[model samples]
Target chain A: MVSEFRIRTETESNMAKQSGSNKSRLYVPEPPFRPGDTPDYSHISVPAAHSPVRPDPLCDADETRDHATSLIRVMRFNGETQGDWVPGISPEIKRTALRDIALTRAMDERMFTMQRQGKMSFYMKSTGEEAVSVGHSLALQDTDMIFPTYRQQGILINRGASMKEMMCQCLSNSGDPLDGKSIPVLYSFKKHGFFSISGNLGTQLIQGVGWAMASAYKNSDEIASVFTGEGATAEGDFHYALNFASTYRAPCIINVVNNQWAISSFQGIAAGEGETFAARGTGYGLATLRVDGNDVLAVYAATEWAAERARRGGGATLIEHFTYRKSGHSTSDDPSKYRPESEPDVWPFGDPLERLKTHLILIGEWDEERHVELLESCKKQVRETYKSAEAMGNLSGETRVNDFTMFEQVYEHALPHLDEQKRMFAQERD
Target chain B: MPQMNMIEAIRDALDVKMSQDSDVLVFGEDVGYFGGVFRATAGLQETHGLHRCFDTPISEGGIVGIAIGMAANGLRPVAEIQFADYIYPAYDQIASEAARLRYRSNGDFTAPITIRTPVGGGIYGGTTHSQSPEALFTHIAGLKTIIPSNPYDAKGMLIDAIEDNDPVLFLEPKRLYNGPFYGDPHAPAKTWRGHELGEVPSGHYTVPIGEARKISKGGDVTILAYGTMVWVAQKVAEDMGLEADILDLRSLLPLDIEAIEKSVKKTGRCVILHEATRTSGFGAELAAQVQERCFYALEAPIQRVTGWDTPYPHAQEWAYFPGPKRVGNALRSVMEG
Candidate 1:
């Protein structure tokens, strides 16, 4: 027994010696900044303004690989459009884009407050990610279908979805267009080319590719745009979309909003520690671009480039929009748990609203007084819309969704079972 | 009319739909060039153009999600999942996107997509390839689940499922692809030549989505079955000399409640049969509904003959399946009381 103990101890020592010599251990990824740590932006690297030159839309996909690694920026920090990537647009359109961005942020704030006040169930804010959707919306045609994530409410807002109706959907009130079928923020403005927002992530990517394929098959010029976060790129559907997109050369644009964080986890968990999300597109032989998402001009210009490419028979283009999630992931999330409170302040790219406003002011297109007035006007309009939606009914009040809605739309042609259920439910409610 | 098997019937439905409507497209893994693994989509690519019938990567989520997109854009997409076992990966897309499109969009958008999968055991496929997932799809609110036991019903129901304005899960019993599986490993495969439900028409005909076919009529006991169990129950009843009213419940969702109530009340006895596991299988739903609707008229408690609650094993499948003896015992028990 003593000899056995000796041998076991000897073996243990031997393993310790081997491990000490090898120094091998499991590698766990850690976030750049943890809670209680001072927020730091030194690790992040952003390319100079307009570092990537604009290529011809018809250029071979392989020729645009470099664009996937470097950043494409049009608006500088000093409020001037720079380099060849600048999209020449009239002042009216730029002002309209700015207005839509403000409106989106205003709506997000109102909805967030409503959730806190027990008037709504949930809310997700696009606080720092506004440019990604608004820029794409302004660049694409109104008929171009968009399969967007919940954070891209700017698509519907820019397309003129009624603010009152949107508020009613959040409240699940009488004026709710969906008749209380979906949860809050799952908006579907089908007539405005806004595809229904699916709570499941990464589903819309393949859907966008398929929509583009159908449009191509029908010989239509209309293209499709899909949005997903950086973390969703790890899903199998993302890879499938790229494979189908490259094989069929579907006319679509895949926008990956790399907002630095995915819920509680950081972006590194999805893209790995060493690789960029934009590099994934180049691997699939797709035309790719990495844009500064906080720079509204850059986002707009990049979307226009990809949209034009898709319109003229070019294949899909993947654009990685680098930004940060300024607020928590949603009302239910607490950013302080996973990230330093100071992270948003030290973000490399500033706020999207401020960047666009600075550009407009730099070009003498507007003044500070006008900016204040626009901000107040957006807040007041959203507040009024909320009041009207509340008048229709809140969750606890008289809702517009009837008992029959549960059985309705299960099929376009109602089966006997559903018909019976509808009648029974109506009687029970009465 | 041409006599065909279940696989042939499926292929005929695709051919008919593609020929009639230019908007219908067929796609899935290996469906374009090699036909499907089970040959259910054989000759479709050749008959239709490559654009209309094509292959996709072995990504079920992408297949279903992309098909939903096509359906929303005014195309009827028939997506083939190689097996029911591999369909779990696509459940999110099928349940969240395609099923809810019309409801979420308030009738502005609808996904007219049909997902076809070969289901059931008895092919020595083990746990990976054989699974009866009809219950999973049936539980989804906006999805329709259909299973056909014979060639005629296979063709007619598949055509109707494809042309339907909502998402349908067309589950083909892999065991009944070429011949009916009566749960006897030693017995020779039975072709549809002499079967009552085998005479399939060449052109378009539809077995409506919500009706049940009364295969045989007797008043002693009512037997409800679908897919492989329908044949198994029929064979069991004949062998046992039991006067059974055998009903083929083709559609699990949107069930024929009227027919079920009528038959169960008249017979005063019921035995539910399925190859899926006994617990929480579709048979349970049938039993609960039967008891709820015809409890006062029932002379005996409803009995269920189903596969055991275990993964389908390769060598021990026969023991796990609800074979003739098990079904016969259930029939006797119900009739005796």
Candidate 2:
């Protein structure tokens, strides 16, 4: 046995050491553009319009794997709209949608300026993500509830929520429905089928599912839709909602507004560099779609498909609105500190407002003169609404919330201790 | 009326409420098919059907999160954490989401949820299984923390908690599930038999929250205890034949301050007892209140008998527990002063 044994060579140990050095290393994702760097989106590969496969609305969840990976684009770069994802929206609805989007932008611009002028404490503008909410709102029924995030102001604008009420809320005036308890932009309209917005991110996801389950339990035809940013998808509530929705076959649509940035962090920090947020759905056995959030038609069509699926008892659909945050995270944030200052201008998806307007013009349904006149009118309306809202008071304290209101709604029926506290507070005031 | 222990009383209360309200749901890990670890939810799924009572994944955070959502959306959700020690995972949902829903939304929306969990230690379940976290929840403003000492209180308080339109933390003393434990670990346990506290009504009833019960009235001293500590203090008082006023503090958050002040003023001496660790224990709050209210009537500094400041030990459970000997010694010292 000793005579038959072969001798080991020096290259063998060297090869082992070389293989150890070639082992895979940990991966850390960084955005393509950083501060002072040139913005580059060439790494993103979007398919041509109508190129991705489309499964039926009621198809098995397993069949949506390819749809999750591919982008469902309806409006091409040349302003031509041609695709299976192009919804059959009438000219009247299209005009209304465009008007509402313009109004939202105008309102946002006014509120942002107000924050700078110290009229409001804070504001978040949905500069590039308007179509995600507006189109989805147009697709859903009036009775269907929506659990929205702070950025979905377009939903309220599209749903005909009063601009005066919105401005009053921002002002935290006496006319504010929440009694000036909530912060600016966190609106609640229970009668309008809009659940209250929570400042803690990702809470609305499960709330939406629970509401849908309640609707189903009541044997109603209504459904629910919830929205969150891509960074919020990393939250545990989002995953919990997916599991509950998939297992219970809840009738709801979960949306991820992938606007690329979350405050100081990028979307890559949410573990989204390797795959689309829409892919998160297919992994949970859900019918999912990745739609061009800039294209109103694409957003409308995908939302309609998902809602139809939910209504027909096909369970939930997760839609990733492929878009970018074209502004700072909020009035308090300065995006220039992290990302390149010119990134928004060089964004590949283009502005949602611009794309929708161009498509309408190319189809001969709209013109530049009408668009400008509409913008001016929207600005005038916002100005008038802001004037009335400020008369009630702004964040600068021309008016204040009634001290008694702080103790009024803590509980439906105030406990003895609360009543005593209220009495003590009144005595102190006296 | 039928005689039953705290565990059965809790289950019966859930069954009664769920039977009346279709919107009421009882769900947790192993609650449906397995009927829960200690069988607190036994026969619920069979009686209510899986639609109303079902098992969820082993995710405490998800359990509380979904329950909050369900409660906000027209369902009266009673979600159970397997144990009090496991509730930290769901603390955010309970504290931030459920508790603050109505306050944050200014009454536009509310999360009326009841979180049920078995708490405290007597069984040798070691550190992970034995933690009394009543103070953690009691510190939350919008939450109602209720602890039940016996069968009757358990059923009545649970029913009231379910009906209350706020998030309620219903902590059931697990060691008292089948038998009454009165501080002496080696003493023969008292089942519902021959105990008046065991005779719970089969029909629906409610014991209002934020009210304390005067178990025994005397002019010598006031002994404030709740949950298992109530039994321990009562046992020691009877064994020593001490003429003391015993008050059971069922609700900790909206504490029955009037009853506490009345007892402390009458007795002129106070001893607070609980099974939780001494530092920041609920006993501290009671001691503060007693001192503040009865500053002139005090015969001695308010004394507290509580568990040591360490993790609940497995083999040395009695050493850590504020048992009969500890409470007896504290009572004697307060009275002699």
Q: Which candidate is the best by DockQ?
A: 1
Q: Model 2 off-target regions past 4 Å? A: A1-27, A427-430
Candidate 1 chain A worst ten-residue window by lDDT: A1-10
Error of 2 at A250 (Å): 1.2
Instruction: Write candidate 1's Cα lDDT for B1-337 as tens digits.
Output: 5888888888999999999999999999999988989887788888888999999988898899889999989999999999999999899899887888888777768999999999999888889888898888888878899999999999999999999999999999999988888879799888877666677889899998988999888888999999999989988898888788999999988898889999999999999999998889999999999999999999999999988899888788889889999999999899888
DockQ of each: 0.66, 0.61
Error of 2 at A197 (Å): 1.5
Tens digits of lDDT, candidate 2, A126-195: 9988988899999999789898999999989988888898888888888888888889999987777788
Q: Per-residue lDDT for A258 in model 2?
A: 88
TM-score of 1: 0.94
Candidate 1's DockQ:
0.66
lDDT by candidate, in order shown? 0.88, 0.86
Provide the lDDT at A175 for model 2.
82
> All predictions: root-mean-square deviation over Cα?
6.1, 6.3
Deviation from native of the Cα of residue A215 in model 1, angstroms: 1.3
